[model samples]
Target chain A: MSQVKTLALVTGGSRGFGVAICEQLAKKVENIDFSLYARSQQGLESTEKLIKQIKPSANVNLFVADFGDIASLQSVWSQSLKKVNFSEYQRVWLFNNHGSLGPITNVSEYVFNSFLIFIDMDQDHLSNFKEIESEITLNVTSVFVTSSLFLKEIKSVSTPIETSVINTSSLAAIQPFDTWGIYCVGKAAREMLLSVITAECKDTPNIKTLNWSPGAMGTDMNKEILVKTKDEGSKQFWEDMIKNNKLVDPNFSAGKMIDLLISNTYTSAAHIDVADA
Target chain B: MSQVKTLALVTGGSRGFGVAICEQLAKKVENIDFSLYARSQQGLESTEKLIKQIKPSANVNLFVADFGDIASLQSVWSQSLKKVNFSEYQRVWLFNNHGSLGPITNVSEYVFNSFLIFIDMDQDHLSNFKEIESEITLNVTSVFVTSSLFLKEIKSVSTPIETSVINTSSLAAIQPFDTWGIYCVGKAAREMLLSVITAECKDTPNIKTLNWSPGAMGTDMNKEILVKTKDEGSKQFWEDMIKNNKLVDPNFSAGKMIDLLISNTYTSAAHIDVADA
Candidate 1:
């Protein structure tokens, strides 16, 4: 008889914390299969390679999908399902981690950019409406659709498996972050989405949803905040954190996240900060 | 010179609370102009007629715009701005009242529907990806874009005027309503958008944003909730409220909302429930 394996699907499983999560799960969990989705093929391939190096017997699948594009996301979801026989898994987990910081600037600069970009700003600029829409789509709407798809896939399995959705949230979801307008709203929406899903799935014993804030991690996202932020105060704060070595290590944060997920320490619709994890 | 008028722009201003708001404002506030946007021409025309009937000399303009469509919204916004010079208004108010109740069903039925619709559901059904996208765009993104546009318009004026955005919100923004997944997320997103805007505009003394929760009102939205909801508990609750005549009158709620807007009693990003108003 074949052994039942655990299935873990993660979005944004290319670089930064995503790669750390894949590596941590590969090292910690035995007989687990991974399905990773990201926009960059190179990044996904490298992460898959790292996971294979960690667990030589682990089965890793990489899918290229842009969360900002619904069509691309749907295509990847369908393809991933075809590659994995979900019914053979003893447990299923979906980690929603893909996000974008959008435009970061001071309130004055944002207001100025709104007008500047309104008249002549390039469409590709971060300040444009299209970019804002893409950020919101990638950060919030994509999670909503992808998580819904994951739930549907879980329901399709003949045998009930332990299932959980760990939504990668941020402190910005609760607190106001100046100049990260779209990102803040998107994270807040994600938290609310998990809340609604958690409430709706209360009767369904097999499924659980949680919002997990990974805390201040030393990832590419943080690097972008430090380098690309236009707000002097915000830039200084991030710089100070980096200089003081205060940012959480990606590997450590990933391990804590996996621990919470495996232990099922949080099943309710609440935000779980890494410190609490 | 003609007296400077107070201009109010309302989305979904054709029926229910929107119409009530326009009527109440027309009757109560003198030297005020109205710009109403809605997809239904008949509704907008009738609303304009009612407003004109109430105030014979009032200037009421009706614009056809579907909140779900960005192009339509931009066209209407431009047309409205062209019609009314911003400098002519002593105060500019935007009522983000347009919204949609995405889907209403019990968890079991929703799961069943998900499976039923999973294979054959048009990608555009409320349960499908497209519908969810549209609902979010209409309920959340439209408000973001419109409010941004309002800010831009306000900036174009030579003289500064008191500007406020009163976002019509719901209890679902904070609470989880089973089967109303997208609606709940959208409302929450709206609240967060208001929050970000409120924070960003803190130093800008001219602009203020408020999320107004128009409690249980006997409007079409409430009737739909009572009739279409598949959640037994929620349906029962609404039915009890109706049976007990507990739903607030639309006119009364509108009056309270307008009073809050004019008085600027609530300047913060907090959710202002109608009962508190």
Candidate 2:
């Protein structure tokens, strides 16, 4: 009797909600294999260590990559996925859970008549656009391409296999948050990417796609929000959420998403938030 | 009494809908000074010629630069706007009307298992990603930054100039077009960018943003759809629309948008489609 094998890959698997996803999947899926991707080697190793502590014989591979560099993302991802013995696995999942909260500022803060000091903004504030560009690359371009490649890699596996692609989404995708313009645009674009994929992949029902809004989680991103966010209203809103201990734990949020997957209760391309489930 | 000198800038102003917008604005805006931007110098000159024919003495200046090049966009936009005597104008407008329809193919067509010949797609087809990337920059990034810079340039105008920034939007921004994933993403992102700006710019009553979905129009892009589009369903959809003459004329659609601006009937940051009016 032959048993089916399972494989999972998680982007941004080095920290926060990504780490939560890695841990939860390891505990829930029987004899699961993982390929983790992140920018930091140390964070990837540490996440691997935590996984190993749970299951000593677990197969976990770490890929370190900066999402901003297109060449690096394409090369590292292609090489790692090329090595997968896809025929041996009956189930595969790609968790596109990695992304950053791009500059938390009003869209207009990027504007101004510098010489006229139109809004008490810096004359050369457009320089701040570099970070915005890098953030866009990580959140939009890389995510779209990564998911595209995931579909590409799975198409070649002759063996009958089920594939699920999940994107970590946010409330900001649907609701406009003050000063969260770039972040909002990125989430909305990512969600639409999955929606388009679902529409295009009906001819291939074996392939699944989802946009899971993880909700407000206690992560490094939240910590950063507390310090450097420029929008006082958004900043205060987060502060109150933190002060009231209203933030969802990363593990809890991740577990809910995994349950949705396990139960197969989600419609493909649905943007189901944690609050919904 | 100092007379109010009205100024208008139209991006993608070389041809099609862009040309329509220039002609309509010059006809309607009461001796409006024109600044036109497009990648083609010849196209810009033609647009200028059309504007000059409409209003023999119209102040038409042409700036030619590729939207995909950041340095060129910055330098050209800045130098052109700097030459403007903002104080002399009581009204300013920017028509962010340029974009492209990128890769009208199913999202899965981008996928494949090369070794197994999983999908009968080209092995190196991801190279098509270059077009998608360029299209996104033209549609989303350039639009966002251009609107931002417009806000910046007008901001320094010490005079109380009533400013309007309009993004030429599409039904695709709110609806999914099968096989038009990249184009849909760009429209959605652009629309949301304006929404966030509207939300953020509440304090600056002088600045207003509008997204006008022009509906389907006879254009070079539509012509391309009949020839190169890979999705039969989408291609047929456009083909039928063309054959039936159900498509909106560029002049008519652009004229309606100009009416919205002239009437000041739209809520700032509101997405108003031609059908609605």
Candidate 3:
């Protein structure tokens, strides 16, 4: 009989921290299975290729879905389940890593005659209602829905498997970021959701939930912050971090995260700042 | 010719803190036009009657609408604008007072074999997916949509009016409430939204925003907490407050809110705890 595998479900696993995480896991664990979900097929394929190159015998499946849309997420989730039966897995690790930075414009620059011109700007453009909604959907609502669905599926399994949800969070989750209004709100909501879930699942021995902030990383997100931000102060800060090599490497952060997960040292619903760890 | 009236748009103004706010504003300000929105027409009528009893000449208009429904909110907002043109008022005070106390059970009692059973419970019951969504809609989404619409209206006005959004917040915004997961998340989002808006409107002297925590109040919400909660600790805490008369009176809190609004002493985007005020 084939040995049952430990399944890992990762959202936004196409590139950046997601790809780094998959790479680190492939190096550390043998005979592990991966189901990576992302919006870009090309990115997903690239990530899969890299993982396969690292571990020749690894089984890597890619699912295309936009976290911003509920129907798409639901469809992708169901398809993923069909590909990998929950009962066959000894353990399940869910990594919620997908998020968007949305429009990064200075609040001060948007002022016209003491009024925020962007507030009434066209929705088709950046920093409008559409962008704000998209940010919230991708960052907050998607995490909430995906985690809830995963928990439900775990509950339905005939043979219970050890499961844990690691939510990708940021300093923005606790601190208010200027010009990143919707994003900050979304991150804060994400942390609160994880905290609440942790509290709710206190007695469930097989389930664990944690919010993990990977700190500032030299990823596409950081690049976007450096390139897209109109705020001089914010731009300078990012530029300085990049120049001084202050940003954390995605591989290092991923390694730390995997170490924490495998050790199961944090049994409670606590936030783990990877930088501190 | 009648002097133009300063208009106040209050959501969830049928009862509780909403009614008290309307009552106090009527008592303090003369020629203040009030537009109260709530789901219960009967409750709105009763509130209007109370306002008139305090200030017989108060122009109190009741608009029946559910804040949770977007269509209903939009229709009511437009109807309110038609009733009193935005140009007619020198100032507008938007009191976002609507919220729901979602699933007030204690986290301590929910442990099952060292895990929470409610995490996988049916959605039809209490503290499920449906209830969580409802709480978010009423508390967070409603505030976002209403404030956005209000800002849009202010932008369109040919004659600018000094407008401010006073979001009725709670300690729950800063502190996590175990069983009130959705409610706590919603409140936190509300505060972040207010902070973002404040940053956006830093240059706009005509627009101001604040998240005001009215402290513990003896209202219908308090009654609900006392009656709906199954957690012994939470029950005892609230009961003790009631027994010791520690809860602030709704009218007194409302009076302080009106004082702050008129004085406009708080210009920054900071949370106002009534007890501190």
In lDDT terms, how accurate is model 3?
A: 0.76
Q: Which 10 consecutive positions of candidate 3 chain A have the poorest summed lDDT?
A: A106-115
What's model 2's TM-score?
A: 0.92
| lDDT of candidate 2 over A112-145, digit per residue (tens) | 3455455654333445344566667788878766
Instruction: Give the Å shift of residue A131 in candidate 2.
Output: 3.7
Q: What is the DockQ for all candidates, taken in turn?
A: 0.46, 0.51, 0.27
**lDDT (0-100) at residue A104 of candidate 2?**
64
Off by over 4 Å in 2: A1-4, A111-128, B1-4, B111-131, B158-160
Backbone clash pairs in model 1 (N, Cα, C under 3 Å; residues 3+ apart or in different chains), count: 0
Identify the superior model by DockQ, candidate 1 or candidate 3: 1
Per-residue error for B10 in candidate 2, Å, reads: 0.7
What is the per-residue lDDT of model 2 for residues B21-114, given as tens digits with 9 covering 90 to 100?
9888878877579889999999999999999888887898999978876656866877888878877787888888888877766665553445
Looking at model 2 chain B, which ten-residue stretch has the lowest summed lDDT?
Answer: B120-129
On residues A21-42, what C-alpha lDDT tens digit does candidate 3 reach at each position?
Answer: 8998888776688999999999
What is the Cα-based lDDT of residue B80 in candidate 3?
Answer: 78
Per-residue C-alpha lDDT of model 3 across residues B1-277, encoded as one tens digit per residue: 1364678888889989999899898987777888899999999999989888888877888888887665566557666756777887887898989988866643222212213445645322333333344455667766766776677677678876878888999887887766777677888888887777777776677888878899889999999888777668888999999999999998899899888887878865678889888
RMSD per candidate (Å) reads 3.5, 3.2, 5.7
